[model samples]
Target: MRRLLQKVLDKSQKAPTQDAPGSTASEITPQVMDGVGTGSEAVDNTQAVGTNPIKISSVQRLGFQNASNSCSHRDLGFTGKIAGKWYAVFGDTLWCAPGVKDPAQDLPGFHGMVRDSVSLLTNDPLTVVDLNLNNDSPVKHQLQFVPFNPAWGETNMYGFGGTSLCETDARSGTGAVYYLVNANDAGLIGAGVAKVVVKSGTPTVTQRYDGTKGHWWDAKTTARYGDVAAYRDERSEYIYLLGHPPSTITGWLAASYVYMARVRATDAFDLTKYQYWWGRQQGWKTKVLNVFTPETAVMWGTGQGQISWNAYYGCYVFVHLAIGGGTVHLRTAPAPAGPWSGDVQVYTAAPIDGGLVYAGVAHPYLDASGKTLVVSFTNNNHIEVIKVAFTK
Candidate 1:
């Protein structure tokens, strides 16, 4: 499986990128997910989102350079521990830091302290303490992030709406922020999930399921798309759900495959209780399909990848952005939908002013001895931040 991929990197000093050379597309989207500019424009929402001043400190002291072009990946990301520490719930908000230690004082969830649904309940600056976590502090307000329906078309009052989407896998479970949403439609014809909650702290969404004929891709299903990262596979009590397939509806996601479905981490939002990952009958099937099935590959896929669960090699990790290449791959799989493992490039930085680099993620709670993880990749309003060392 690509030698189980273990390329390390951690020079320990370069780490610093703020990407602001000229920025605009509302400044490369207030936080990320900044859309527009298609028809072979691919992405250039107005360029200038820079920040590769080149200082890594740890991508193994910075040596990878070789990116054999393996290609493979998906996200919003999901993790929740709060009070007990470890927190990071996706583009929706909650990246934490109350009394942290390493990773530079853990500084307001380390480099991406968020809260913006236009700053949730309102204190505004969101929250940040030191290593700049992107600046602006004070607005902590307990914890907030409630937007779910920009009336469905989502004109970015602050983010949410799927574009090149292929998501699923974002959870805090019963406590909320569940996830599995879609935005430009044509997911063959189906896909849905965006729970949110925040237990009293104002998070919202309530519940949404969308599976039966509101179009199950009109019964043709071949994994159209789900939230993009939902690992609750605690040895299979079942919670899987990762997905992809709907970029322009026929790009075939490079070579496609990395579709899955499951329910029962307490019915996970219900949608008839779901279950699909037949892999030609390897297991759970029967979700419909009578028609659309353009993607399926539990491996070698990447439209925008990220399926974390890499507790220092406990397995299941997949970070992506290697199709047109800026490097930044890394795959592994014991499950959570995968046979994965054939893309260990690790890190290579390149798209800052030329404009379009994308979603490569892997935060791993900002690394607490998980041998150092922190990966992030953007480039249109730039964001690059690598520190790899997944060693086992």
Candidate 2:
């Protein structure tokens, strides 16, 4: 894992000069909004002052069955909203419907890992779903996977690296890092394998020796697990990945850590070019600080972990996981890259799951007022949407 991290850190430094093959750098300008070129100003201008608490309406599910063949929505980790429409990315499926209240039946096509008894082990396909606001979709042109077991989140989505440790296809080995691109000009076929940029990284797909019930896959090659958040802030483009590494000596330890990486707009998607930071535990006091680049410390806590941001806040919210199973609390920062403040109870229930919250995605939206924030997660087979009301 150390070797893998070193390699990725090296690659991230070398920015890609080309957008794609034919696509020029001029075509892919930094994302802009409302006369402003950066996200921060636009977010501040749109914030709802003295706004009411956000109201959440249950939208329909993507209609996928579980391992038991019952109606189940598994691992709805990351979500994105483009052009007023909502999209949820889950394991093996990408679901799309009109609004938060649209019926599940209204959603079209299952994009990945179709169910079949004979091919149970071999057919698992990892997918990421998001609505394309730039284009119109009779069925909503969603991105699909060319490789199997693709690990994705609201921010970063990439193919699993290294070899597969599963007893099923241990022979094929873990695949390389690949990105999906438009297979056809119509944008109907979804994304297909175009290139393999990084090879032999960390986090092989394998069941750990300890009997953890779920798939304990790391987002990157490191010993961390959490969601990834990305957006352009104040002329700087940032990608934040919240990772919780295995804390116990044996395989059963429950403790976790969080870290982040940042890159300038000039940098490419390569992993080496960015700066990194790790969460530290110091004799009952925990601190989240940067490990690479100009060293800096951010937040310190005994509890806070999984972090997400609202462009409206101009900062990231550090969510504290309750001990012995309780409600999650939130803390805010001026930037996703932060010197974070203390905790504030944002929601009484677990943000991701009603029983056990796993992952969440927070995106800023505009309504009748100005900027209103909506946070969504897949909790116990149901996608719960919560409206966050900011206090002055």
Candidate 3:
């Protein structure tokens, strides 16, 4: 227990000790707000969503629901440490209706294991966030649950392992590996990052940095897309990560674009070595604010997103919750930093027939045949997995 507590504290600081000498910590001022509160054991939102609960299990590779509704899955959550190893994405937001329940009431909200299928993990609140009294007030001071809602839920936190582990490259599906996951400060709006060894077959927590928000690649910034998807671009030998910077629009935190950032894959854990895709015609530029003004060539299918290299297509394929949220779209790029193609249709769900649907996950590992690609998403009642075949 002491080991776990210590690990959480270590990862909580966003300021990594490995940062390049003299690097300044991004002042986490306005972008992130703060909140902390109580939680009840998971509630049954299934009744509110009007769907009867079903059993949860690994779904088949293509377009079918995983029978895990009884577990109260957070549909749009993500996974961690990809170099093809089996790891869990530890933080997840609760599945909530548009206006039905206050998500903040989801104290031990958002926690799970994101693999080929979604698995309900633990909901132990670990990271802690002490926020400025008026999160929006220019005069700042830390307060308890100051800003009520926690952002970055749908896009949960996790990243992939690099070559350092188990001979894994950017695209390997399984390996003897290390998985570093950022579990959010449970019950808090603005929380620090707790770097837990989520899954490499066994889970452990090595460190934490609790002063900033819950993502290791990010500090407390108001608008950001986190739960970073990282991979080592064997071509460039530099590790590339597709990140989303989220903003609150019309009172909901939704995202529309995907950002690019890179560092030597060996330097994956060092925040200082990383560079951002500024989207200038000139491409990547190093900046300290860690901010980007123009987005990459592609826009997000849904605020929640995913990008993976599909060998069958011979390009990086991005799968997302299509604009309306009932379908998933696929776009391809020759390079990780892309001149991306517009999305080609991939999978469509029952929303066309009238029911709520969102959260799409791509499982390239399932495409053993190389001619087929796999994708998954969930409705309030069940998690669906789909397989896509390429013709010509």
Candidate 4:
């Protein structure tokens, strides 16, 4: 516990004082609101999205939902290391749904409302936002659960799915944080961004939603490049972003194409500084208009997932979901830009209560050996964890 506390305090000191080269703090005004109240678990909305729930013996279940205080959330389980501690962030959370016992039905007032939350992870169980360390908030010492967007669940104008995070190169003391938030509805309002600044062991988070959203690479429309996963390249002074280009609709399953982009370590928030990977022939393109299209996707057939460097495989591993099917697929590349290997079926997700299982991602920080992985995906209204090991 002392080690965890030290890590949090250490991250506070490393917060950057300014945005990247082209971006400034005064550009977007922040809106600060109180934390969300706790409630009962929620059930899955009626959508025949993915395959039915099937338990596989090889895929070891970690039971993250059973261990946490807030067990009922549709979390992507996108994790990152903060102060050497692994933390998972959830997207659409249910505070108080009508029926807790019934898995098939969602009440009218409910329908799986979204309230984003974060979790602290251990081996067997995961801790939710209710950690009562020491704080003056109304939650009383608990880490506050703030919504990524206050208007997240509002009809078609401003409904959001969730966000993907990356440790930026811009650092002062040690740690730097940034999020590529995809905040849109069925009507296609598209995405935005949020910056999390830690100070003196406490965190200050801010979100911006408007016309000029999505910063550098992505646009504020469904037809633009939206960030799905991000990681800072240890070999280079840049952070590589894995984008899901919704415009490249090869099939009805989802965007079958993915793209790559990078920004300098110090200029993470400067969207204008981002450059897209245009393949080995063309290299990186500085102009957004000349960036990647469907023809230049880093990988195809999977639109959503996460990327991390795997020492075991000696490659950059991309673990993504079969959006239309209930399977988790993986690809490996020498660099973030590819010669990416073809899809390998790592795990098969079994959706509960006729729910669609998607958001297959790997927690790279949890795996010490690249051969064994800690993976997470959403089932119905909750998230589940599993272990996948590859033989040498």
Using TM-score as the yardstick, the better of models 3 and 4 is: 4
Better of 2 and 3 by lDDT: 3
Q: Report how far off residue 78 is in candidate 2 (Å).
A: 2.1
* Model 3 misplaced stretches (Cα beyond 4 Å): 1-25, 28-72, 77-84, 88-200, 210-238, 246-255, 289-292, 295-302, 352-355
For model 2, residues 3-36, the per-residue Cα lDDT tens digits are 2211111101221121112222113222111212
Question: Which of the two, 1 or 2, has more lDDT?
Answer: 1
Which ranking of candidates, highest TM-score first?
4, 3, 2, 1
Candidate 3: 10-residue stretch with minimal lDDT: 43-52
Specify the highest-lDDT model's number: 4
Q: How much is 304 displaced in model 3, in angstroms?
A: 2.1
Error of 4 at 19 (Å): 24
Q: CA lDDT of 159 in candidate 2?
A: 25
The 0-to-1 C-alpha lDDT of every candidate, in the order given, reads 0.40, 0.29, 0.38, 0.50
TM-score of 2: 0.42
TM-score of 1: 0.27
| lDDT tens digits, residue span 40-152, model 3 | 22111001111211112222344333212222233443433433343323223233322223323323533333321222222211111111122222222212111111443
Using TM-score as the yardstick, the better of models 1 and 4 is: 4
